[model samples]
Target chain A: MLFHVLLLITFIIVILIYEWKHYQGRDRYVFVMLFALASIYLLAAIVDWRIPEYVQGVDFLLSPLKKPLQAWLDQFQI
Target chain B: MEQKISSIQFTVLVFMNTLGTAIIFIPTIATRYGRENGWITVIFATLLGMVFILWLTTLIGQEDDTNFFKIMDNRVGKLISYCLILLMVSFIFFTTFANIWSIAQFVSLQILMGTPPQVLALISTFTGLIAVRYGLEVIVRSAEIFFPFTMLSLTLLALLVWPEAQLIRVQPVMQLNQAATFVGVLPVIALTYMELIVMLVVLPHVNDLRQAKKAFLIGGGLAGFCIIIVTFAAIAVLGVDGTVRHAYSIYVLGQNIQIAEFFERIEVLVAFIWFITIFFKVSTCFYFLSIALQHMLKVKNYHSLTVPLGMILLATAMTNLPNIFYDFEMMNSTYLILSYITGLTVATVLSLAMLIRKYKEKVK
Candidate 1:
């Protein structure tokens, strides 16, 4: 946990130093977005929050078709 | 000045990327559905994959210095191209996370039982981050360096394990349900070649366009051959039941290797092949994500984004993909479907669009 926190801090520092050193007008928003994503990830880790698995979402979307897909695939089963 | 890699380096990257997680997981999955006929399924998948690669190279066309994004933009216009690029980026990101999580999971379970997965995931992500920071030239060159040793080790493992291979175990060949063998090809294709659509991003970076296409085919073909050999060896040595029983069947095959009562229990040492290949896989995916993000964000340099992106990947790998079982379930189901949709479907659509545009111009 401490290691994760320290790692997150180090990442934040690196982001800041990188943006400072390679300050480009177009990349400012990109860095800001990255920083926001990093902060959210850190907060989730600290809170021990279960990030919703993207696969689950995909599974949910495909659930209705799962049986049909299986049945279709089964037709090929000799 | 733009960085470029030679065709040989590109081939090595393709080889490593195709082997990626497939090396660890292919034998089990192939044997599960195809049974003793599993190796045949892999061969079938490779043939299909070759067709897919040929199509992809055609879509990339005669351009010496263009990427998938540029091709899509030229054919389909900005809005549609952006949409497709975003989808490709999402797919690339998912793969990067998957590779990171897989290596971490393997290390935690097999080697460092006490280490937290997050730490392993961070280490994997950091390695990729460092590679990405140096750019494509370094990444491909490193892959080139590691390619020979990884292949040699794999070849040695194959040769040493040959003594244990019982032809009787692989008997009754091609007698399995033909449908099942065909069905087995989907996952193998999805995991190996379809996942390789990420390479299209780096295709423009290869110095020789024509040779790079040939390299692509050769690399993918070689990797497929490796998988086929490993799958056959597992079946011949461990039999179908034993192959499907373990999560990492190739590792189990390594465990079965005994040479002159001296080289015993060398699975850990044999695992070096996977470590090197997976590192290249993760790094390649990470590099793709950085490139995709740079294009999406109009960033001047991709270097600045790798650290934060790596952090996010670490967190995601830690938070999601709770265990190997979940990953297996995902891989067998949703990931397979997603691969087809994002990989084949998208590439086919882009290729058709390019054809229509060309036809229209010719008519004009």
Candidate 2:
């Protein structure tokens, strides 16, 4: 977790540095995407703080992939 | 920001990048079919990999300069270039993402079983993005510095286990059947060389055209050697049954190492090395994607693409992969085909076409 946060901070800083040096219209969309990513990280952090320990809403966003993997895991333990 | 890396650095980077992930899986997967004869398939795939490299080199060598995407643009058309770019992006994107996903799963399986693999992935993504943000020069430099140690440590590990490693494990050499060894090595051949596709983005940055083809063969050979040694050791020590049963066989080998019983738990050292090598692998791919994105969208500032590409890669990694086994299966089947067959074939055809074009111009 500490490791991830530091990387994210570094990433955000790199983008800002790049934008400051070469601000242009075409690059704006990229910054927009960065901002959205930052928001997801922030939101995920918030969810970790408020939600029940086992209940993760993010995993559902990837339900299609999770089902089969879970089924494979179940083969061993279930 | 792209400094010209020598043929050695390029070769080392590829070997270090591909060897880490494959060594852990190769023995077990190979044993699933070939038993001891699995090593033979490894040799076969490696030789074939060289053939792929020679062909890829032949293509890149044409015209004194030009990269894959550019060749596609010229040979096919602008629209086709766009399609090729899109395909390349998806290839790098999914493979990079899938690697992250598996690394997380490996962590979860090995330690921190309760923690979501997502957390480990996020850590890797951020580290990878930062590495890519600085550009390929930094990534290549660090990989060069570490590549030798990566191979050395793996060799040292095998040496330590030699005393206890069972010869009978890989014995009767095809007890499992030839299909297993063939299956085991073939997929890895594809995925590792799929990484050669990194050249599509990185080649244009090469200052010397002379070193291009040499780099691929050298790298492929080194990586091939590393894979063979690790897979052979795993079979020799753990045997086919143990190899087949263990998910990350190499790491498991570390767990059993008892150098007078004092040097135990050093598997942490192995894991740390795994972390660094895999990080290098992920960052290299991430950096290339950002570079390619800049070229595709005509973005003036290539740096801006780093975070956005990183985010998409991470998010896609977390979602596009449903679970670990399915991802493994895909790497085994479809994705394998794309990297080895499609990637190698297209590189051969495109380069041949480019060479023919150059010859005609010179003759006229």
Going through the candidates in order, their DockQ values are 0.47, 0.14
Considering every candidate listed, which one attains the maximal TM-score? 1
lDDT of 2 by residue, A5-44 (tens): 6776776677577665565687877666666764464545
The DockQ for candidate 2, computed on C-alphas, is 0.14
* Tens-place lDDT digits, model 2, residues B1-364: 3256666667767676766566666655555546676666677778877787676666554443334465566775787567667666766776687778778888987877888887788888989988877777777788888876776787778688787777666677655455545555556576665566765555555656567566767777877777777778777877767766777877877777788968875566567657767887788778767766777877777677776666666665665566766666565544654455447556765766677777999999
**Which stretch of 10 consecutive residues in model 2 chain B shows the poorest summed lDDT?**
B59-68
Looking at model 2, give its docking quality level: incorrect
Off by over 4 Å in 2: A1-22, A33-78, B62-68, B174-176, B340-342, B355-359, B362-364
**Tens-place lDDT digits, model 1, residues B179-209:** 7888989888989999898898888888888
How far residue B307's Cα lies from its native spot in candidate 1, in Å, is 1.6
